[model samples]
Target: MMPLRTIANRVECEIEIKKSRFVGVVDRAATEADARAVIAAARMSDPAAGHHCSAFIVDSSAGDPLADPKQQRIERSHDDGEPSGTAGMPMLEVLRGHHTTNVVAVVSRYFGGTKLGTGGLARAYGSAVSEALVHARFLTRQRREIMTLELDHAEVGRVESELRRHAVLVLGTSYAARAVLTVSAVDADSTAALVASLTAGRVTPVRSGHMYAEIPD
Candidate 1:
C-alpha cells in the first residue's frame, strides 16, 4: 500500500502588538470541507475580531486523482476591512513556509486602533501566525487495518497480553463464550505477527479493513 497521508495533531502561534492581539490556530483536517468548518468555528470564537484570514492544505488519500499531487490546498484571507493582501497573503506565506499540509490555519485580529500600514499588517499577521504554530502539539498518523479477534475464554489472556506487547490497540472487548477483541495494528505484517504469536499458529484473525489514527507521540 502507498504511504499514509500527513496530518497535524495541533499547533499554536501568537502575535503580539503594542496594543492588539492576533492569534493563529493550526489544525489537521481530513477534507476540504472539514478544513473550512474548522475555520468557521475559529472565527465564531472571536466574532468581534477585525479580521480572520486563513489558509489550508489538504492532500487526498492514495490513488485520488482529483487531489492535487502538489498537495490539495486552499488559502483564503479576509481583509475584515483591512487593505487587500495586507492580511491573508502573509498568513498564507507562514503556512507555506512551515511546510504544513493537510492542515488549516486561521488568524484572528482585534485592531489596536493604530494603523500598522501594509508592511506592518503583514508583519503582524505573520508574526501572530508563527506564535500560534510554536504552541502547537502534533501527532503523526499511521494507516492500519482493524480486525476483531474471537478466542476461547482460556486463550483470551494470552492473546491480550501478546497484542499489548506488540503495541496493538485493543479498542474494546466483549465477553461471551469467547472473548471478542477489537484490534488495530499499523500494518498487515504486524497484525499477522500478533495473530501468529498470540494464537500459537492455531487461530487466524478476520481483518475488517484499512483505517487511520494518530501514532502516539
Candidate 2:
C-alpha cells in the first residue's frame, strides 16, 4: 500500500459567523477509541461549548477498530445538536478530499444568541476544519521492516557511514561487547545486501519486525 498522510500534531482553529463561534480541532487517531478520546479532550477544554461535532477516518493497514478485515477503511461522523447533515458531513468531506487517513476532526460551537440555518452551519463547520488543516503539520506514514546488525566495535563507524550513504534509515545504535545497530528499510533483502557489501561480507542483518515510521510530507 502507498504511504498515508496524517497530522503530526493536534491543532485548533476558530471562526465566527452570524455571532456563532465555531472552533475546530484536528489530530491523528489510529482507532475509534483514540478518536473518541480526542473528542472528549476537546470537550473538556471548552465545557461551555454547545455542540461538539466529530468525524474520523482510519486506515485498514493499521489495526482496524471495527474488526472488519473486508473494510480497508473506517469512516464516521456526528452532527451533535446541529441540523441533520450540516455540521459533521461537510467536515468529513474535507478529510476525504485531502486523502487523509488516521485522522479525526471535531468542531465545537458556542452559540451567540443567533442561529445559523442548515446551509450556513454546514459551511461554517467545513470552513472551521479546513482552516485548521491549513495550519497543521503533515507527515507520511509507511510500514517498514526493522533489522538489527551486530558487528565488532571497530567496524561501527565505517558501516554506519556507508549505510547512510545508501539512504538506509538508522534507528539507533547500542554499544556493547559488539556494536548493535537497529535500522529500518522498505526492502529487507536489499538492506541486508547493502550491509553485506559495506562490511565486505563480514556482517549480516537479522529481521526484527515491522512497524510504521513517519516521514516528512
Candidate 3:
C-alpha cells in the first residue's frame, strides 16, 4: 500500500487588515474525506462568516491491486461567496509558491463593516494564505521501507549498532530463541544494504514497502 502524504504538523493563526478578517488554518490530513471534514467543521464554526473558502491536495494509492498510477499532484479550491477567482485562485498561488503538496489550506473570512472590492479581496485572501504557510509545520517526505532481520543473541548488539549507524529506524524487536528486529528505512536500497551488512551474508531480512510520515509535532 502506498503511504499517504500530508503536512507533518498543524498550524492556526489569524490576520486582519482594513476591517477584513482572514482566519487561516493549516491542517494535516491523510485522506480527502478528512480534508472535507475539516472544511465542514470550519464552516459550522463560523456560520455567519462572509465566506468560507478552502483548498487541498491529496494522494491515495494504498494497496492498489491493479497497480493504478499514483497521483503526484491534486489541487482544489472553493470560492464560497466571493466572486469567482478572487478568493480561490490567490490561495492556490500561495500553495504553488511554497511547492507544497498533499496539504490543505482553508481561509475563513468574517466580513467587516466595509466591502473589499475584487482586487482588495484577492490581496486579502492571498496574504492570509501566505501567513498560514509561514506559520505551518513541515515534515520531510521519506520513503519508508520495513524489513525483518535475523541474528543470534550474540550478534544482536552489534547488528543493532550498525543499523543505528545508518539512521535505520527500529520499529520492534522479537525474541523466540533467536532475536529478530523489525526496521524501517527510507528506501529499498537502504533496507537491502542494512540487511546485508548486519547479516554478514548468513542472515537476511524480508522486504517491506514504503512508509509515510505521521503528523508532526
Go through the candidates in order and give the C-alpha RMSD of each one to the true structure.
5.4, 4.0, 4.3
Who is ahead in TM-score, 1 or 2? 2
Runs of candidate 1 exceeding 4 Å displacement: 1-21, 25-49, 56-77, 92-104, 110-120, 175-177
Candidate of highest TM-score: 3
The C-alpha stretches of model 3 lying farther than 4 A from their native spots are 1-5, 61-73, 174-179, 187-199, 204-206, 214-217
lDDT of 1 at 144: 65
Give the whole-model CA lDDT for all candidates, comma-separated: 0.71, 0.86, 0.73
Report how far off residue 192 is in candidate 3 (Å): 4.1
How do the candidates rank by lDDT, highest first?
2, 3, 1
Question: For model 2, what is the alpha-carbon lDDT of residue 204?
Answer: 86
Q: Tell me model 2's lDDT, rounded to 2 decimals.
A: 0.86
TM-score of the candidate numbered 1?
A: 0.65
Summarize candidate 2's per-residue lDDT along 79-128 as a digit string, tens digits. 99888899899999998777778899999999989878888899999999
**Model 1, 34: alpha-carbon shift in Å?**
7.9
Q: Clashes in model 1: which pairs?
A: 11-136, 12-132, 12-133, 12-136, 13-131, 13-132, 13-133, 14-131, 14-132, 15-128
> Each model's TM-score, in the order given?
0.65, 0.77, 0.78
lDDT tens digits by residue: candidate 1, 102-205: 77778888877777878988888878777777766554445667888888888888888888887887878899988888888877676776687767877787
Query: Which candidate model has the greater lDDT, 2 or 3?
Result: 2
lDDT, candidate 3, residue 91? 88
